[model samples]
Target: MVFFGKKSPITGKQNARKTTGLKAASTRSIINKYHQLNKRKLQLQGLKKRMKKAEEQAKEAEIDAEITQIDSEMEKLGGLEVYQKASLKGQDQTRGGDSSHVLLKWLKNEGNELALEEGQEKKLLEVGCLSVSNAVSKSTEFDTIDRIDLRSNDPLIKQQDFLKRPLPKSDQEKYHVISLSLVLNFVPVTADRGKMLQLTTKFLHPQGLLFFVLPKACVENSRYLDGELFDSIMASLGYEKLEETTTDKLIYQLWRCRQEKAKYQKFTKNEVRSGSTRNNFCITL
Candidate 1:
């Protein structure tokens, strides 16, 4: 945690360093501030170290200097309370009786090899996976995922080339499962939704499964294609809806897609004929 004096707002020139006076704080004061900030930073970093090491050390010494440094840093970076409140509000929004966690738990526990395929040890694919955030692994027994693919760039997944890469063919001749969580709702790219599904399905064997989480939310003015319209799309592509559960809101649902009676078949249509319809957002905040 390094601290610097304010820079020139217009010229964007960095202030020159000085040994003393207004050009810089006193040596004694600067040293004291850095020492205090460094100590707190080290302490916070240590907390993330092995729990054993943290337990061995006594609590950080209560120091007015350290508190003052922290306050200064907070002020320079924007008040801590602002981010705290925003984060808290986001948590509240996700906690409002969503079945995502419950469904994830069920899939993790009961899904097993059936979800993957016969003779397969364990392999999973996440389609339209976003930044590894809100992943189902947290709400279920699954921890590590084999692979994840996202259409958008995120801090954790900045490489866009990964999306265009072709999936390696699997050796198994049985079913394989690919999980799509809250991703199919944003498939607005023209003529790519079905192609993307087919592209992924080609990686699986005969009885592979495609698990999807569809949002019923308003996309009246949306530029992307979503799952609500995918019902006909999936059916046309030989993918059958196994289970679907709608929450109190029509804009969200948990659904599963598997191949029809005869497996390994691809969709015949390349063009979507339905005119785009605009839906109203009914959810009252």
Candidate 2:
């Protein structure tokens, strides 16, 4: 509900922050622009590395200048954390859907079928949590709902990176479920995506559930990922896919931790799917 009063690029004035919400196109444009700038920054950095090795001092300097400019623009957009908050706004009920809301409804309908111990309370760890009152937070299904994000806008959500979260001292400290909706794709490093998946297993109890979600384009339209490859990746990490739901915009999946110790397999960034305009999304394990 807070606005930083960031100026509108189109109007050259403070964008009227409305509680109602932005036009769908306007919201989408902001998100797309952020992605374009981020991708360009990475591309330029790669080119600069090559230029430095070739002794092209002048070209490298030019790249640095571009990088500095990009950094300024990144600040103007309020960086990834702020951009994510903006995206969350777009997912508000007024705008059509909140992913957590759907997750809550799905869980409620399938509550009886979940692998939970009779009369025992379950705990959940929600990574990339942005709000204190998200649907899952209000649900009674979980006795404890621990929320964390890279940065905190509210006191309720711990301001810590999930990757750096301390190891649990006992089984009680581990969670029965872990949620990572719309989280993995935001990780800037491709390899870290795999690492994050690996670390989630350590934070969950035996037979724990993992709720993972991503933009459909990540697996459906990317150059290096597909349904089969994604399944294999999860299987290699000792997770058995329990549920999968696909929509025009996103893919939601539930995976159960399994002790398939002998089934572990190494994965790499290979071109499993390809097309000229497909996105370059891949996980290296």
Candidate 3:
């Protein structure tokens, strides 16, 4: 679910891009447009959900039309798969090819205080999974890795939305680790994002690990969210940050469930901070 820059939509050339300022500018442009389109798509999806709930025909047709338009645009821009490939390419060109390295590191770190009983097999859920060959998938740490994405054609990655997945009924059905890499920001509705977070508790084993990843800007530069605020939200949900790392483009955090559904603060879209060019990323409960 990693989202970042991509190949030039028109030229599709990278030799020149590899050695000049033009590459950075091109990457920024593609990434910006990618985020813009993704935001609009999620908004339309939220509207569609409301339309389904209300069972009203008044705005349904128009909403469907707009969604079609956006889908067409996304198809031309290569969908999320292309963005993921581009992200992998950058990783190959510079750092490691996936965020799983960090997640695995967090799990192995001694600072993670969640002590597991010996011989306890680990189960992992990789939401918004794009590939079956990812590091976590191949790792021996987990007894099993259930990979899923909202849109996927690969047989290995189930094409199912996490929100729609059946809720776990018992500890046996819950996962030991859940990877939410770059998936939260894709959730357009602020409340829905919070709902998604809360829902994780039902699917996770007590004291399980959750690896959360987001674009650096979501916390660093968003008008509605900041580092402290995001921390409070997770803490209120009973998730304690075990480790956190911020790169130039991404925010990675490994959290342990301390308590589930604890008393928490409620937040809204009120202006918490002001900036002329800030992103409107926020989560609510």
Candidate 4:
């Protein structure tokens, strides 16, 4: 069954914002506000220069609108009064938080080395990691990963060969955990999706958890149809449906029960006979 959780609220009260005497606070807030205004003004100037150099008139207009919005927001907060005062008093101002980083941080905390026992040669693979390399690099758990990046352009692992490479065919019984996020949907382009699933079973030790973030059609409109197809592929390839929550009709987070390779051999053979989509991104990109 799919379930959805409400969005978490921001917690600003716990932040280290400055609290000073009424007179001092007023002065600091005004100073801080002005400093921010000045910084934004400089950024706008820089953006205008870039826009002129690129002759991107439409982009320049969009940027102008954004700067105007920022100005309006600043005015609503207190014009330059709040920032100017804060700067003069060296007081810190509070801003609202981003939930993605917060959620990642909490997940890292839960899965850190201190939270899990140390082991030799911890295997970790992240496909379609994109710009989150820093986050993965800093993870207490991924720290232990013998980092195997599948989609890397670096001349290390043969591109897309990881899917075809022989995995621990009968060893779907020993790893502690497996994680896939915003990645599975990309498989139809670079590798055989069914082969990837079989490889997953081969790599995962028995009892290992399969954690994945399902594609959101709203966010990944191009990949939405493929994402649904992949979910069906997962079930056929031996993943037992476990907990899955719908963030919305278009987005879902899921956990699947693990399965072994020998059990799905017949299904895999049938998949091989029917040929599949491959190397679409390589051609498009």
The candidate that wins on lDDT is 2
* TM-score, every prediction: 0.45, 0.82, 0.79, 0.40
Q: Which segments of candidate 2 are over 4 A away from where they belong? A: 1-21, 42-60, 108-121
lDDT of 3 at 236: 86
lDDT of each: 0.42, 0.75, 0.73, 0.42
lDDT of 2 at 237: 85
After superposition, which runs of candidate 1 have C-alpha atoms over 4 Å from their true positions?
1-119, 131-135, 138-144, 149-163, 172-175, 218-229, 248-285
lDDT comparison, 1 vs 2, better candidate = 2
Q: Which parts of model 4 are misplaced by more than 4 Å?
A: 1-122, 148-160, 169-175, 189-191, 218-232, 242-252, 260-285
What does the lDDT come to for candidate 4? 0.42
Worst 10 residues of 4 by lDDT: 1-10
Residue-level lDDT tens digits of model 3 in 1-285:
212122233223322123222343455554555567778767666656756445554667666766666565556556666555444454443543488888988877897744456776678889878677777777888888888888774898888888889998767788888899888987777998988888887787888888999989888889999998888888888998889998888999998886745667787776778979998899888
lDDT of 2 at 66: 68
Measured on C-alpha atoms, candidate 2 has an lDDT of 0.75
